[model samples]
Target: MRYVKLPKENIYEFLGRLKEYGTLYAPVKISEKFYDFREVDDVKKVEFHYNRTIMPPKKFFFLPREKLFEFSISKAEYKETIENVEPFVLFGLHACDIFGLKILDTVYLDEFPDKYYKVRREKGIIIGISCMPDEYCFCNLRETDFADDGFDLFLHELPDGWLVRVGTPIGHRIVDKNIKLFEEVTTQDVCNFRDLEKKRAEAFKYHEDWGNLRYLLELEMEHPIWNEQSELCLACGNCNTTCPTCRCYEVQDIPSLDGDTGYRERRWDSCQLRSHGLVAGNHNFRPTKKDRFMNRYLCKNSYNEKLGMSFCVGCGRCTYFCPAGISFVENLRRIMGIEDKSCPSEISEEIPKRGFAYASDVRGEDI
Candidate 1:
C-alpha cells in the first residue's frame, strides 16, 4: 500500500487534474441535507463529508434507462445499432458504495456477462472517500467497513491533510503523474490514520451482529412484524431504485414506426413491484406485498449465501429514501430479538455452504 498526503487547499487542483481523463463524478449538495453524484467541472462542488448520497453511484455503470439497441427496417431488411460507452472517473465514493459496486461486478460480470455493463465498468475508475459514519449506517455489521480491495484509490480524512491509499496500478499511475499534489507519507501518518479508524469503530456501534443475521431472517418469514411494518408501504420502488445492490431488471421489445423492426431493451426492475414476476400466462410468482417484502430479506440474507456475500451493502440508501420511514437496521434488530438486550447464538444452523462457481449459476434452489 502506498500513502500520500494532499493539502486541503490543493484538493480541487487534484480533482481538476483528474478531469483530464474523463468526466469526474462526485457528491454535490442538491438541496437542504441532500446530496447526489453528478458530473463535476468545479471541484469545489464535491461534498466529500456528507453521510451518504440520496442514491448510490450505481447508475453511472448501470443506467436507470438505456437503449440496448436501435434497429431500422427497409424492404423487410433490418439493421441494428449499438452504442459505445465512454470512460469516466467516479470520485468521492463511500466504502458502502464501493461494496455496492463490487456486488454489481459479481452480478453483471459473473453472469452471461453483460457487455454493456462490462464496457462501462472497464472504462471507469473508482475514487473512494472514507466518510463519517451516520446513525443509519451499519456497514460494519456486514463486515464491509474497509476498502474491500475494490477501489482504484481510497482517501481518508486527516488533521493536516488527506491520506491517499492507492489500491490498483492505475491509481499509482495517477499518483505518479500528479506527484506535485501529494507528499510522501510518514510512519506517524499511518499511525494517525489507524487511530482515526479505531475511533470511528468505537463511535458507531453495530445495530446487529453479522452472525445473528441468518437466524434472524430464517424464522421471521411468517412473523406478523412484516405485515405491521409494510402496512404503510407505498411500494413506490424508491428504495430499490436507490439501493446500489438491487439489480433486478425487465426487458421490452420496442418496434420502429414502420412496425417491421425493433430492438430489445433491458431496464432496471424492482422486486417490490407487483408485476415484477408476471408471466405471459397471467401468472405472478410473488403477488402480495408481504411476499415481496419477505423475498427481499431472503435474497439479502439467505439466498445470497451461495455468493458468500450479502446483497445489502448497508449503505442505508433504502432506509433513507423510504417514504414510510421503514428502517432496515431497525427491522434487523427486531428480527434478531436484540431489543431485549440478550445476546444470540453466533452461528445459525440454517446457514448454508457456498455453492456454484459463478453467481449466475447459483440459484435460490441451490441455497
Candidate 2:
C-alpha cells in the first residue's frame, strides 16, 4: 500500500479525474442533517463530513426492485436484463459502509452467485472516506470503524490535505493518472494522521468489548428484551430497509393482462414484516412480533460464521431509522449485563489504527 497527499485545493480536480472512469455518485446533503448518495453533478456538492447516508451503497448492487428476466407465456424463453449494467464510482463511503459491502460480497460473490449482483460488483468502484463516529454509531466496538481492505481508494482527512491510501491496482492507477495533484506523505503528515486517528477513536460513544457479543446473544435467546422491544416495534421494517448488511429479498412474477407474457422481479424484503415467513397452508415460520424481532437481531449477530464476521457493521442505520427508539447497541448491552458502564473519558488501551500502517509499525521491515 502507498500513502500520498491530496491537497484540499485539488479535490475538485481529483473528482473530475475520477469521472473518466465511470458515473460519479457521492453523498449530497438533502436536508438539515440528512444525507444520501446521489448522482454527483458538481463535486462541490459532495458532503465530505457526513455521519451516515439514508441508504447504503448496497442498493446499487442488490437493487431494491429489479427485473430478473422477461419470459414468454407461449414458449419457455427468458432473457436476462443485466447486459446493460454500466460502470459506476461510489465515493465518500464510510468505513462501516465499506465493511457492509464486503459482507454482501461474501454472500453474493461466493457459491451460487447471482449474476445481477456479480455484474454490479464488477462495474462498481468503491472509494471510501474517513468519518467521525456519531452518537448513534457503534462501529468502533464492532471493529469496523476503520476499513483496511475492500475499497479501491480510501481518504483520511487532514488539516490542509487528505491522506490517500491506494488499496488496488485501479486505485493506484487513479493516483498515477493525476500524479501532479498529489504529493508524497511527509513525517508531519504521518504525525497529523496519527493524531486524527486518535481523536476519531476517542469520539466513539461506545467502547465496550464486543468480541463476545455473539456468544452472549446466543445464550440470551429467550431474554425479556426481545419481548420488550417487540412491543415497541411498529413492524415498520425501516431497520431492515436502512441496514447496509441486510440482504433479504422477495421475488415475484408480474404477468401481463393476458397472463401469458410476463417478467420476473425481485424487491427488498424485511424479517420484521408479517408476510416474510409465510408459506403454503397459511403457515408463517416467524408468526409473532417477538419471533421476527429476535430473528433479525440473531441473524445480524450470531449467523454467518463462515464469513468470520457479524452481519451488522454497527453503521447505526437500523437504530437511526427506527421509529420506536429501539437501540441495537443498548439492547446488546442489556443482554451482556453492561448497561451501567459509561464511556470512559480516556481510552482504556491504545487503539490500533487501520488502513496503511506506518513503516516503523510494519514488522520484519527495514525502517
Candidate 3:
C-alpha cells in the first residue's frame, strides 16, 4: 500500500485526467439533501462531503433493468444483448458501498456466474473515498467503516490535501502516471490520518451490541418483532432498491406483435413485494406481510459460509430511505433486548459463533 498527498487545488485537475481511463461517475448533488451517482460532466458537480447517495454504485455493475438476450421463435436463433460495455471508473465510493460491490461479486462471479454482470464488473474501476458517519450510519458496527481492499485507489480528506492509498496494481499505475499531481506523505500527515480515523469513529451516533445479533436472530425466529415490523411495513420495496447489496431480480420475456420474436429482460426485484414469491397457480411462497418481511431480514443475515460473511454491509441505506420508518439498529436492539448505548469510539471485539460472521472475519478468522 502506498500513501501520498493530493492538494485540494489539484483535485479538479486530477479528476479531469482520470477521464483518460474511462467515463467517470461520481456523486452529484441532485437536491438540497439528496445525492446520486451520475456521469461527471463537470468536476464542479461532484459532491465530496455528501453523506450517502440515493442509489449505490452497484447500478453500474448490475443494472436496474437490462435486456439479457433476444431470440427468434421461427428460426430458433438467439443472441446475448450486452453492448456499450466500455470501461468506466466509479469515483468517490464510500467504504460501505465498495463492500456492497464485493457482496455482489460473491453472488454473480462465483459458482454459476452471470455473464452480463461479469462483463460490467471487469470493466469497472473503483476509487473509494473516506467519509464521516452521520446519525443514520452504523457501518462501524459491521466493520465496513474503513476498507482495507476492494478499491483501486482510496482518498482520505486532510486539511492541506487528501491522503491517497493505492490498493491495486491499477491504483499504483494511476498514481505513477500522475506523480506530479501528488506529494510524498510526511510524518505530520501520518499523525493527522490517525486522528482522522478517531474522529470518524466517534462521529457515529448509532451504536449497538451487534456481537450477539446473529445468535439472537436465529433463536428468535418467531419473535414478535417480525410481526410488529410487518404491520408497519408498506411492502414498498424502497429499502431493496436503495440497498447496495440487495440483488433480487425478476426476468421477463417481451414479445412482439407477431408473438414470434422477443427479448428476455431482467429488472431489479424486491423480496418486500408480494409478487416476488408468486408462482403458477397463484401459489405464493410468502403470502403474508409477516412472512415476506421476515424473509428479507433473514436473507440479509444469512451466512455465506464460503465467504465467511453476511449480505448486509451496514450501509444504512435501507434504514435511511425506509418509508415505513423502520429503524434497523433499533430493531436489532429490540431483538437482543439491548438498549441504546452512546458512541464509545469502539465496539466489542468478541465474535459470535452462530448464524453469521462479522465483516472483519472475511479472511476466515475463527468466529
Candidate 4:
C-alpha cells in the first residue's frame, strides 16, 4: 500500500473531481446532531466532521425493502424485478462501518453469495475516512477503528492535511488524476501516522480481554443480569436496525386486486421480536423477552467465535440509540462480575409488567 497526502486546499477540489467517477453519495447533516448518507449534488452541504450516521452505508446495497419477483396467481409464471442501476461513489465511511461491512461480506458474499447484494457491491466505489469517536465508541476492543483492507481509499486526517492510503486500482486512479493535490510520502509522515494510531487507541473508555470474553459468556446461563436487562428492554427493534451486522430479513407475498399477479418482497427484519421465531399452530420458540434479548448477545459472543470473527465490534450505536439505555459492555461486565451494576437510573421509568413464562428460571432457557 502507498501513502499520499491530500492537501486541505484540494478537499473541495477532490469532491468536485470525484463527480466524474459516478453518482456521489456522502454524509449529510439532516438536523441537530443527526447525519444520513444521501446523494451529493452540492459539495457545500457535505458533512465531514461527524460521529456516526443514523444508518450504515449498507442501505445502498441491501435495501431496507426489495421486491424479489412477480408471480402469476393462477398460472405458475414468474419474472424477476431488478433496476438497471448506475455506478455509485460512496464516500466518507468510517472505519467501524467498514469493518462491519467486512463482517457482512463474510455472510452475503463469501458464504451463500446473494446476487442482489453482489450487484450493488460491485457497482459502488467505497472511500473511508478516519473517525473522531464519541463516548459511545468501544471499537478499540476488536480493532474495528481502522481497516487494513476492504476499501478503495482510506483517508486519515492530520494537523496539516489528509493522509490517504491507496488500496485498489480505483484509489490509484484517484491519486493519478489528482497527482498535484497529493504529495510524495516521507519516512517522517509514516512515523506521524503511527503516533495518530496510538492516540486514537488511548481515547477509548472501555477495554476487554478479547479472546476470553467468549469463554466468560460461555460458562454462564443463569445470570440475573440478563433478567434485569430484559425488564428494561423495550423490544423496539432499534438495536437490530442500527446494528450493521444484524442482517436478518423477512419475506412476504403481496397479491394484486385481480388475484392474477403478486410480488414477493423482502424487508429488513429483527430477530429480537417474539414473533420472529413463531411458526404455525401458534407455537413460538423464543417466547420470553429475556430469551429474545439475551439471544442477541449470545449470537454476538458465542456464534461469532465459530466464524472466527468478532461480531460485537463495539461501535456502541445500540446503546447510544436505545431508549432503554442498555449498554452492552456494562451489562457484559456485570454478567462476568467485572463492575458492580446496580439498578440503573434509566430503568425506573417503566418496568416490563408482563413477560412470557418459561419452564426454567435461567436466562436463554428457550434458545
Candidate 5:
C-alpha cells in the first residue's frame, strides 16, 4: 500500500544503492529481444521493459540440477548435502514471475515442505517491475498478471518515472536504508499508478477465459482435440522446462567407477518425456504422446483446483517454447468450442502448426 517515486533519470543510482544491502541480480540483456537474470554491479546493465525472460527466477531457487546428498558405495550410509546459500536480491522481475514464485512456494512449502526450496525462499528478496504483454501472454485473464504480495517491492512504470509499492519489512528497509535515493510520493503519483494498472489489465492481447476450468477440463477428457493436437506435439518437454509452474524433477544417484563413493542429484524433469511415466520392468503408464500432452493440461486445470489456484496462471510460456507449435490457449479454445485466431475456419479440421516464427508477435512457437 505504501507508495514512493523513482525518477527514471536516477534509477541507476537506486539500483547501485541496493548493493549496499546484498549481492544484486537483475534482468540483464543477453542479446536483442533476449534477457535473463544475472548478477550485476553496474545498474546500467539491467533492462526492465522486456516482454519476458528466457526462464523464470525458479532457476536460482529450485536449481535445475543440484546435489541432494552423498552416499558410500560400500556401506548403506548416506548424508543430505543441500547447499548453504547466501542472501541476495532478485530485481526487475515481472509481476507474473513474482506470482509464479508464489505458486512455487505453494508447491514446495505448503503441505510437504521442501527444505532446500524453503531455505532459498527465506534467503532471497523479490523486486518486480511492471511489464507489457504479447499475444503469447494470458496471465492477465487468470488474474496472475499483477502481484499484491510475493514481492518485497513492486514497481509501476509511468511516463515520468516509476512508482514503487513496498510490500514487506525487507522492502521497507531498502527504502529506509537508502532514504536519500528516493523522493516523497505526491498525489499525482497515486493517479499515475492507477493509470498504469488500468493500462496493464487492458494490454493483454489474449484474454479468452471460460470460467473455472477444473470441471470443464475433467469433462473434456474424451475430447477429440487431444488426439488431433498430439499429432503436432513433439514431446520435447520444452514446455515443462520453460514453464514457471511445472514442478517436476527426477532424482538420480551416480556411483564412482571404483565403487568408492556416490552422490545423489536432482534434475528438472518433463512429463512429456517418454520415460516420464515409465515404471520398473519397462511399463509406461501414459504411453502415447497425446496422453502426456493431455496430462499437462489436466494437472494445470483440474489437479490444482483445490489449492484454490488455476495452475496455468496463463503465462503462455508453454506455447511460446513448444517446438511442435502447441499453443495451450489455442488448444484450450478448441476443446471449449471457443473461436481462436490460430484455428482453421472448420472446427473439425486439424490446426496447422505454426512455423519457427518464434520472435513474431503473432506467430507462436516455444523457446
Candidate 6:
C-alpha cells in the first residue's frame, strides 16, 4: 500500500485530471438530507462525508429503467439491442455499496449472463471510500465494514488529508501516472492509519448478533410475527428501491408515437408487488402480503447462503425507508424467537407445512 496526501484544497485538481478517463460520478447534495451520485465537473460538489445516498450507485451500471430490445409491430418480430456503454469511474462509494455491486456481479454475470449489465460493469472503475457508520447503519453485522477486494482503489480519511491505498494493478497505474501526488509510506504513517481505522470501528455498534442469522431463519418458518407485521405493510416498495442488493425487475414493450416500431424496456420491479409472482391464466403463487414479506427475509438470508454471500449488507436502508416503521433487525429477532424464549417449547413433533399456506392460489394479485 502507498500513502498519498491530496491537500483538501487541491482535491479539485485530482478530479479534473481524472476526467480525461471518462465521465466522473460523485456524491452531490440534492436537498436538505438527500444526496445522490451525479455527473461531476467541479470537485467541490463531491460530498465525501455523506452517510448514505437515497439510492445506491448500482443504477449507474444497471439502470433502474433501460431499453432492452426493439420490435417491429408489422412483422411481430423483435431484435435484441445492446447498449454501447462508455467507460466511467465511480467515486466516493461506501463499503456497503461496494458489497452490493459484488452481489449484482454474481447474479447478472455468473448465473445467467446479462449482456447489458456485463458490458457496463466491465467498462467502469470503482473507487471506494471508508465511510463512518451513521446511527441507522449496521454494515458490520453483515461483515462489510471494510472491503478487501472488489475495488480498484480505496481511500481512508486522514487528519492531514486522505490516505490512498492501491488494491489492484489498474489502481497502481493511476497512482503511478500521478506519482507526484503521493509520497512513500513510513512506519509511523502505517501506525496512524491503522489506529484511525481501529477507532472508527468502535463507533459502529451491532444492534443484534447477526452471526446466528442463518440458523435463526432456518427454524423460524412458522413464526407468527410475519403475519402481524404484514398488516401494517403498505407495499410501497420504498425498501426495495433504496436497498442496494435488490435486483428484481420486469420487462415491457413501448410503442413508438406512430405505433409502427417500439422498444422493449426493463424497469425495476419489487417482490412486494402482488403481481410479481403471477403467471399465465391469472395464477398467483404468493397472494398474501405476509407471504411476500416472508420471502424477502428468506431470500436475503437463506437463499443467499447458496450463492456464497448474504444479500443483506446491513446498510439498514430498508428499515430507514419503511413507511410502517418495520425494523429488519426486529423482524430477524422475532423469526429467531429470541424475544420469546417459550417459542422453542411450542415446536411440534411433526413438522408442519413448508410455510406454503398460500400455494393454492395460482393467480397472483395486482399491485
C-alpha local distance difference test of each model: 0.78, 0.86, 0.85, 0.80, 0.79, 0.78
> Clash pairs of candidate 4?
none
Better of 4 and 6 by TM-score: 4
> How should the candidates be ordered by TM-score, best one leading?
2, 3, 4, 5, 1, 6
lDDT of 1: 0.78
Candidate 1 Cα errors over 4 Å, as ranges: 72-81, 205-207, 303-307, 340-367
Best by lDDT: 2
Give the 10-residue window scoring lowest on summed lDDT in candidate 6. Answer: 354-363
Per-model TM against the reference: 0.88, 0.91, 0.91, 0.89, 0.89, 0.87
Q: Is candidate 3 or candidate 4 better by TM-score?
A: 3
What are the RMSD figures for all models against the true structure? Answer: 6.6, 9.7, 6.9, 6.9, 7.0, 6.2
Worst 10 residues of 3 by lDDT: 340-349
- TM accuracy, model 3: 0.91
Please state the error at residue 65 of candidate 4 in Å: 0.4
Q: Which stretches of candidate 6 lie over 4 Å from their true place?
A: 1-9, 257-260, 303-307, 337-367
Candidate 4: misplaced stretches above 4 Å?
303-307, 341-367
Give the range where candidate 4 is weakest over 10 consecutive residues by summed lDDT: 353-362
Which pairs clash in model 5?
320-365, 320-366, 321-366, 321-367, 322-366
What is model 2's C-alpha RMSD?
A: 9.7
Candidate 6 root-mean-square deviation in Å: 6.2
Q: Over the stretch 1-367, how does candidate 1's per-residue lDDT look in tens digits?
A: 8878887788889999988778888999999989999888778888978988877888988888777765666555444444566778999998888888888888889849888788888889999988778888888887777775788889898877789989999999999999988988878878889989988887675644566476557655555557877777788788889988888889888997778778878888998899997888999999888888878777776535434668887778888889899887777765665542222222222434221011212212222
